[model samples]
Target: MGSPRAASSRSRAITEVCEAKLRMMGGSLRELESGKAAALEEEILRTDAKLEELGQLADAAARDLREDFEQAMELLQSTRRVKEHMLVDHRQQLGDVAERIAALRSVRDEGVKACEAADHAEMVSFLSKHASTYSQECWQLLARPLPRSIQVPLDDIPFEVAKRRDLLRGAQCSEKLARMKNEVLCDIVDALRQERSTHADTREYAVEVESLLEAYATEWEKRFDYACSYCGQVLEAALANEPYCGAMPGRKAHHWVPTDTAGIAEAKETARPQLPVAAASPRLKSQAKIRAISPMFRADSSV
Candidate 1:
C-alpha cells in the first residue's frame, strides 16, 4: 500500500511540473506576440507619416505647376491680343493701298486715251493730203475701219502718182512719220505706266513704314499712355506728372526756350516814352501872318 501511494504522489507531482512548464512557455509566447504587434503598429505609423509627407510634396509641386501654367497662359493671351491688333492694323493699311491703286488706275486710263487720240489725229493728218492720188479701191481699203494694222512700206513705195518718178519715196516718208508718231505714243504710254508703277510702289513702301511705326506706337502706348510725338519717351502716369511740361525732364527740354523774365522787366522799365509829332507854328498858319512876315523880310529887296 505505501509503495502504491508514493508512485501516485510522484506522478501527480510530475503532472503539476509539466503543467507549470507549459504555462510558462505559453506566457513567454504571449509576450513575444505582444512585442510583434507593437512593432507592426509602429511600422504602420511610419508608413502613414511617409504617405502624408509624399502627399504634401505632391500638393506643393501641383501648386507650383499651376502657378507656372497660369503665368504661361497669361503670356500667351497677351501675345495673341497683340497679334490680333497688328492684323487689324495691317488690314486697314491694305485697304488704304487698294484705294490708292484704284485712283491710280483711273488716271492711267485717261492717259492711255489721250495717247491714243493723239496718235489717231497724227494718222488722219498724214493721210489727208494724199487722198486724191490713190485709186478708189485703195482709198476704200484705206478708209476701211481696221484694227491697228495700217502698214506703210518705208523702203518700197512711190513718191508721186502722176510722174511716178520716186513712188517709194512718199510711202517711205509716210512710214517713217507713222513710226515716229507710234514711238511718241508708245513713250507716252510707257511714261504713264511707269508713273503709276512708281506711285504704287511708293504707296506700298509707305504702308510698310506706317505698319512698323504703328507697332512701335502700340508697344509704347502700352508702357506709357502719353508720349512725345517726336521722341520715344516712356513714363508712368505718376511719373509723367512730376514734370508736366517736358516728356523727359532730366534731359534737355526740347522745343522749350528759357525766357529771362528779369531782363524783360528791366528792359521794359528802361524803355522811353515815344515823342509826339510837332505841329506847324501858329504865326505861319494864317495867310495874313505869312504876308506880314514876307513884307518885313522883303524890305531890303528891290522887288
Candidate 2:
C-alpha cells in the first residue's frame, strides 16, 4: 500500500482545476442570490406601503363617520372586506414561500449528503447507512455486477484445481464472464420488451419510465455486442460502455481496446512506424558518379 504522504503529494493538478471550476460557479451563484434578495426586498417594501395607505384611508374616513350610523356601517363593512382580501393574499404568499423553502432544504440536504459525509464517518459506513434503497435493490437483482472492462474473475486458484499443475491457471475467466453477461443481457432485453408491450395499459407515468428503460436496454445491447479486438471479450450489458481491460499486465488497457477513430489517428501520428534502413554501407548509395582512369595514362597510346 502507498503511504498517505505519497498519495497526498501525488498530484494537485486535478484539485486545482476543480477549485477553479467551483470559483466560477460561486461567482454566478452569488450574483443570482443578490438579484433574488433585491427583488424580494422591493416586494416587501411595496406590500408595507400598500398596507399603510389602506390604514390612512380608513382613518381619514372614520374621523367624521361615527356620528352617522349609515356611513359608519358602510365604512366598517368595506374596511373588513379589504382586510380579509389582504389576509388571504398574504396567506397565499406565505404558503408559496414555505413551499419554496421546503424544496430548497430538501435539495440542499440530499446534495450535501451525497457530496460530503459526517466528519467522523468512513465512506463505507456512509454508503451502508445512506445508500439509495431503489439502487441497492436493482444491484441485488444481479448475481454479480460485471466490470465495465474485461477482468480475471478467478484470481484465487482453487486448491483442488491447483493440485493439477497441468491445468491452466486463471483459465479464461474473461471468456466465461463474457458468456454470462450475454445471458444476463438477453434476460434484460426480454424484461424490457415485456414492459413496453403492456406499457400502454399501465399508468401514464409508469409508461414513461418503462419506455425509458426499454430505450436504455436497447442502447446497452449495442455496446455489449462490440468485442475487444485484442481479447475478443465483451462486457456485461450493465457496464458495456467501457472499452478497456487488463489483458496483459504493465500494458495500457486502451492499447488493445479499439476506441474513437480520431483517437486512433492521433495515436498513429504519435507513434508512427519508421521505414527500415538498408544494411549496405551509405557509400554504396552515394549520389556521386565514379569516373574511369584518364585515357592519357593508358599503356597503349590512342591508335
Candidate 3:
C-alpha cells in the first residue's frame, strides 16, 4: 500500500542486515571446517606410511623364509648322496670280510679231513696185514722156512716123522699141525719179523713214515717262520726282510748288529786284535841265558 520508493528503501535495509549476519558467522565456520579437513588428511597420510612399512617388513620376512627353504632342500640332497655312497662302501667291505673268513674256514676243514683219512687207511692196512700174515695159517709156513733163526729142533724129534712133516709144510700144505718143539713160537715170531723186513710193502711203509715226519717238520717250519731260527724269539711279521739278531756257535759272539749279510762276521774277525804267544817263566829264561853266556856266572852264583 505504500509508494515504490519507500518499499525499495525498506528492502535495502533488510538486505544490509542479512549481509552483516552472514559476514560475522562465515569466517569462524570456514575456519572450523578447514581445521577438521586438514587433521583428517594428516591422519590418513600417517596410517598409509605405517601400512607401507608393515608391508615392507612382511616382504623381507617372506624372502628370508624362501631362501632358507631353498638352502634346506640343497642340504638334504647332498646328505642323501653321501648316505648312499657310504652305504655302498660298507656293503662291499662286509662282503670282502665274509669271503676271507669263509676261505680260511674251508682251508682248515680240508686239512682236518685229509689227516683223518690218511690215519684211518693206514690203521686198516696195518690190522689187515697182522690178521692175514701172522695168523694160524701163515704161522706154520713161517715155522718151516727157517731162514736164519732155526727153531724147528729137527734133531730132537723123530727124524722120519719130522722129515715127512717138514716136507709137507715146505710144499705149501698147512691143513694140519705138527707139535714137536718147545718155546719155538717166540723164535718163529722173530723169524717172521725178519721176513717182514724184506718185504717191499714194509720198505714202502718206512719211506712213507719218513716222508710224513718231513712234512710235519716242513709245516712247523713254515708256521714258525717269523721266529728267530737260533734263539726261538718271536719276531715282527711286518718286516719283509727282517735281519736276525741271534747268536751262532760259528760266529762265537752275541750280536746287536743284524745278520742280514755274511760279511758281518768276517768284518768282526778282521777288526779283532790278535794276542801274542805267552813266554816262558823269568827264572827259566835267566838260567838258559846264563848257560848260553858262560858257566862262570852260574858257578859264582852257586858259590
Candidate maximizing lDDT:
1
Q: Itemize residue pairs with steric clashes in candidate 1.
A: 157-167, 157-168, 158-167, 158-168, 159-166, 159-167
Give the alpha carbon lDDT tens digit for every residue of 1-303 in model 2: 898877776656668888999999999999988989889899999999999999999987887564455654565576667666766676676676566556555655664675575544554554565465534544453444332332333333234323443344434666788899999999999999999876743565444444444543453343224446655665346445454555755563533244344533443454321223334423322211111222322233321
Pairs that collide, model 2: none
Number of the candidate with higher TM-score, 1 or 2: 1
Task: Tell me the TM-score of each prediction against the true structure.
Answer: 0.24, 0.18, 0.21
Off by over 4 Å in 2: 9-18, 33-40, 61-303
Task: Report the Cα lDDT for residue 150, model 1.
Answer: 28
lDDT per residue for candidate 3 within 195-255, as digits (tens), equals: 9876755565555445444553553333323445566454544533545343565543222
Model 2 accuracy (lDDT, Cα): 0.54
Of 1 and 3, the candidate ranking higher by lDDT: 1
Candidate 1 TM-score, C-alpha based: 0.24
Model 1: per-residue Cα lDDT over 13-115, one tens digit each: 9999999999999999999989898898999999999999999999999999899678766766766676667666766766665665565555556556656
* Candidate 1 residue 166 C-alpha distance from true site, Å: 92
Better model by TM-score: candidate 1 vs candidate 3: 1
Candidate ranking (lDDT, best to worst): 1, 3, 2
The lDDT, on a scale of 0 to 1, for candidate 1 is: 0.57
Q: Which ten residues in a row have the lowest lDDT in candidate 2?
A: 284-293
